[model samples]
Target: MRQSLQLIFTLAFSWTLVSCQTAQVKTAPEETASASTGQADPSRQAAAPEGGVPELTEDIVFNLLAGEVAAQRGALSEAYDYQLRTARLSGDATAAERATRLALHMDKSELAVEAAALWVELAPEDLTARQLLVVMLLRRNADVPVLEHLKAIVRISENKDENGFLNVMAAINRELKRESAMELMRKLVLEFPGDPRGGYALTIAALVDKDFAAAEREANTLVTDHPDWPKGYLVLSRVFLAQGDKAGARTLLADAVGRFPDDPFLLSAYARLLVDAKELEAAYEQFLRLEKVEQEQGDASYWLGLIALELGRDEVARGHFLRLLEIDGRSDVAAYYLGRIAEQRKESQQALRWYQRVEGGEHRAEAELRIVRLMVATGESREVFEWLQRMRIQYPDQVVRYYLMEVELLREHGTPEQVMALFDTAIGALPDSNELLYARGLYAATQSRVDILERDLLQVIANDPKHADALNALGYTLADQTNRHQEALDYIQRALALKPESAAILDSMGWVMFRLGRYPEALDYLRQAYEKLPDAEIAAHLGEVLWVTGERQQARQVWQEILDKTPESEHVLEVMRRLKI
Candidate 1:
């Protein structure tokens, strides 16, 4: 009977356990049904933890059930409250962090802020939360949040990331003010002195205000510290140039070019700097280095040719210019220079051929001038009459000398009445023109009487002070024949000033001195003119000056050169007779 009684109690206990399990199972569906009924406080009745209380008393449970549904429905505020309560109840930091992040994603800005704050607490060194919060705060332009979050990041960041953080602060300061920007950048640079970009930012700020001294100092510091980087040196050089320290800038670039011999950016900058410094020879050498560096024939040849032409090394220039054309590069510019080179060599047919191949513009004006000048110079002016007449129709404003040349030719070829008619046709188009006055000046200069010549040459000088021919002729005529020594010197000096490279002007200066009886000075000027230009007139004048100055050997040499050029010329023979050469 005791065994049966024990068995019956075991059975009753088993049945009681089974009944409780069945009841719990039955209540889970009921709770789910109650939660699904869309009641306002539905979580109050939802299923809780396994074998736990399934009642409406837990505020946390109510939030959990409702929060998920509300979150899915875009109700982020409710979702955050539920996640916070769930976190407190379960004591799960990682789970809570996930829920907080979800809350942020659900369009709950206020809740997102709080969530971020809590997440930072859970994972105090979490860079994601710190960076995200800072970015969010900045996007909203909320100064309070931004400053607070940036401070948090800074405090947490290692000194190595100090510059990185300051980069953000500097950008914010751009919108905020200089004081704020400088405060952040200054501290960052102090802490992270190794970051050259940070130093550049400081320099950039100075450059913005044109503070060259500050910019140069900072840039030089960068170059000193980062000796291998060319940009720092380049930045310093630019700052120096912008401040008008061209010599300083050139020195800096020269050093850079020495250090970084083949760096294209450095080389190019240095070359351009040298050009600005009027160090043309150095610039040419650098340009040659660049051209040869790549063995790029077309480009190298072109730059070399251009610099040669600029320095007046035309024959040497033409070979490279022609070589560039052989490479079939954009040789229009080269073609133009080649034409000028040919014109200088007195190869008019070749010059005309090359110039005619070029299309029209300001570039073609020289070609057009070459055509007329060659015709006039060679006494073939009749062939250019139609060409000059056509130039009058086109480019009316800037026809270089067609009107003047035409007037001269007309005087020679036509009757006075016919010449006057031609002048009437052209003069109306060029009223108040220096060219017209110069044409008239030259015409009057070739006369028996001096009255018209005096008026016209004065008018020419009045119209254009730099009309070197008018100055030279007027002064030389006065000094040689009229004997106005002081006034002649004044006009010759002005002519020399205007046309400093003209051997003719230099010759005029020498002649005026000869008339003044300053023999040594006269010989000095004449010798320079003779060396510069081996022309017959200049040679004759130089020979006379040399004969007077007791330079008989040099005088004979000068006259001999002229005799070869003009065997029948009286000036050479007369000089030969005087020198017994």
Candidate 2:
């Protein structure tokens, strides 16, 4: 019986080899090129040897069969053992590579290192095997072997190409600690004194380590030594930016762009910096130059469209986005912008058509929301609600967001009762959603349903005790509507502690202080809030505190400033009516 089973297994294994021979033939050229040049092809997987079928002894056949069976049964550790044994006995690089990958998948780091070492030994000319060994050794912090393999990789590379050094740098950055990566880069730079890539990599490593002084020194040296290299100047600019010298960085990039007028990278960097500085016209010009210089114009067109929009050149923006639609992977974004341009032009049906064409990408949800708004604006409220319901089903991950949008739409176009009913239904469905509870609480506060507001806000606070907005809202409601001065102060203090820079929390603290009759403290907090956010409600609070403190003229000036901006300001009018001003 055992002999019969062995013969059956041997025949099956032979058939498997026959089936894989075609694949092996197809991959031999790539593997041969990679082995000769030490350039690793990521798509090249281990396959049957190119020479032909080897003499598979009983041990090799049995181990190969057992490993495959174990792997099929989800016994990865057993599979690794069998495969490693097969690799050792048969001296097959393919078997060794498979064992290494299996061990890695099982997260057996020590076993993976052992298998990778075997793979490198069996196929010393294979750059991928050496790279894998380097990564495994780096994970184990075996610096000596890691350095040895890294140097070997560089030596095997044709004419010691900088790509080998860059690949090693990437591995070190990903696997080693930041300090260790920096140290490794320093050693690589010293090993290859005249290699510009080594110095650039070291500068990047130092920048990532936040050793700005080291980064600046290395980047400056790189640019001075390699004056013709654009990347050195780019690194120097990054160093400047990292050190918070935006003007210096911008000036450096501007000079770089002048020197390398046809370089798309330099132009893109300078244009982005100009955008950051709000120099929209200058940025738009740079992008226009980039659009001409770049072979692939999608990125340039996208930037030109955005900068044109910011500059209020709607027709120019529209032209760029329309051009972007011709590029692959950019159609959705272009469609979204075209919709925005149509909306700006008040071409509602055209806007809807463009928005509907946005089938995917980051803008899909925003496009759907815009479509809903347009429908409501055109008095298709019933259709809008039906579409939102279908959207909730289609995008399960965004169900809560859709529910919130529905509630908002109701608040705008429907009635308060409808909004409240939708909130209740949404809460029943998403009982664990803190956002829904918080929104409903805020809405309840608006309607003066203090009991419902307290219930929902307390529920949100119970779920997430660190909900600063809920704490602030509940406290502000109590201070504004009821006489629970001490209770309101406690909650507001907690909220203020959580978000010390929140303007809303500051306003709540001021309101609570005013309820407590601490007029001077109220004036201080309200002034800080108003300075942080010059909203009409905050201005109202600041003016009232000023009026109470006998600064009536200054209070009137504050109110008048906001009223001039927002002529029908409800908060200002209500305060004036209450104070009989």
Best by TM-score: 2
Tell me each candidate's RMSD, in Å, in order: 22.5, 8.0
Instruction: Please report the candidate that would top lDDT against the real structure.
Output: 2
The local distance difference test score of model 1 is 0.67
lDDT (C-alpha) at residue 516 in model 2? 93
TM-scores of all models? 0.43, 0.81
lDDT of 2 by residue, 309-347 (tens): 878889999999988888645889999999999999999
List clashing residue pairs in candidate 1.
none
Q: Can you write out model 1's per-residue Cα lDDT over 511-534, one digit (the tens) per residue?
A: 999999998888888888988988
